[model samples]
Target: MTAAASDINFCFPVRELESERVKLTPFIPDLHADLYFQGSAAYPELYDFIPWEAFTDTSDFVKKVIEGCVRPDTGIALYAVIDKTPTGTNPSKPTSANFAGIMGYTNTSPANLSTEISYALILPPFQRTHVTTNAIGLLLQYALDSPPHGLGLRRVQWKANRLNTKSINAVQRLGFKLEAILRYDRIFVGSKTNAANGERERAGDPRPGTVGTDTALLALCWDDWESERARVLQAMDRRS
Candidate 1:
């Protein structure tokens, strides 16, 4: 049986199995308040990583995420990573969660077998930790365990701005093979001017400027993921 067929309980409304050190829960409404306030305060460094040019208010960002979960075409599957706290005065307190580490496929254009691993964000505190690695492992498990698409998924893709070295390193460590770089596929603020136009266009607006920059695409096949997982687990065991 395919991974999908064996993993029926992996669907939405399902609280994904908590990692040995973390819990993966579906995003909730009130998290907006905590995440917007505490997250921004705690992990200000994250502003440089993910796109947040459009979030003006807490409610606006929350609403946008909610709409994505409910929408069909551009909607996404989301999860909040709750770090395990030791038994203490506030054992129930959540230490960290990826504010926008939204994981899900987009443009399953090739029917059941092919899907792209799209957007994900990790708040600063969670970086360099096992949270993202295991969270993604869970996501991959869900995808592979589900029917029709199980194991048949030819690729699990990760695309990011070439400047995002942290993301690049993390995905690489997770065993994703670095693929080709598409030149000038993405435009950026620094190089937003076309050769003909002397002035640089605004960041969000579409212009003829090529930026001469491209998104770096990385990919992991089932074998790659399994190998990576084994390596990660082995490293964790050695550390323990």
Candidate 2:
């Protein structure tokens, strides 16, 4: 049986956001977990900036990421990215290569009308292509476009490991402004497989890994959307 979004207890209304270039659907573990795992297993470097590793197997992925982290109850909802832009220049139709990558919302707060774009991982084949730009632009539009077309959220944020220059640059390119740096953001449990590197835990500390990591915080408030939307679209339109 193909599992539904509810299987992971997704919090939102479960809308599929898309564009001429990409599609973002609620991630269903039973259907997507295996594909995501297989693709990522061969590319561990892709996860170097996150808190978790490339997952040993499908079961490990389902148990740790799907069940443990990205659940409605946990305030994190994931989506699967699908590439629709046919191969070739200036393609005008949908070819949908399937499973381009993954992205999600974290720390969502309807009351405050805020959310953070997190867990973005574009597979090796799709990186540096239209998939990333369109996927992010769709999410921005969905979160900031106001009622009748979007969640009308007041704010959307992007967080990354402070040491991840690539990630920091990517989000900033998408319209999020660097707000501040969070000191001692998280503990790496003395392991650096997922993060850039780490400093030893302080004296008398027991964690045994990097004492903690610094986080780069960035955001795009609703006020910035009117201008950023057009700018983001312009970026998506670039052929190069």
> lDDT for each of the candidates?
0.52, 0.78
The pairs that clash in candidate 2 are 190-209
Writing each residue's lDDT as its tens digit, candidate 1 over 1-240 gives: 112221222223334445566555654445433564456554444544333333556676655645433243432444565555334422134443334233445544344454555546555565566666766666665554434434446567778666667778877876778897655555444432321123344687665444444567888776665556567555333322
Error of 1 at 62 (Å): 2.0
lDDT tens per residue, model 2, 23-129: 78778776677878877888988866676766889999989977777763656778887777655632222123467778988888888889988889989899888
Cα shift from native, residue 195, model 1 (Å) = 19
Off by over 4 Å in 2: 1-5, 72-74, 86-97, 193-200
Q: Per-candidate TM vs. native?
A: 0.67, 0.88
Angstrom error of the Cα, residue 31, model 1: value is 4.3
| Candidate 1: 10-residue stretch with minimal lDDT | 1-10
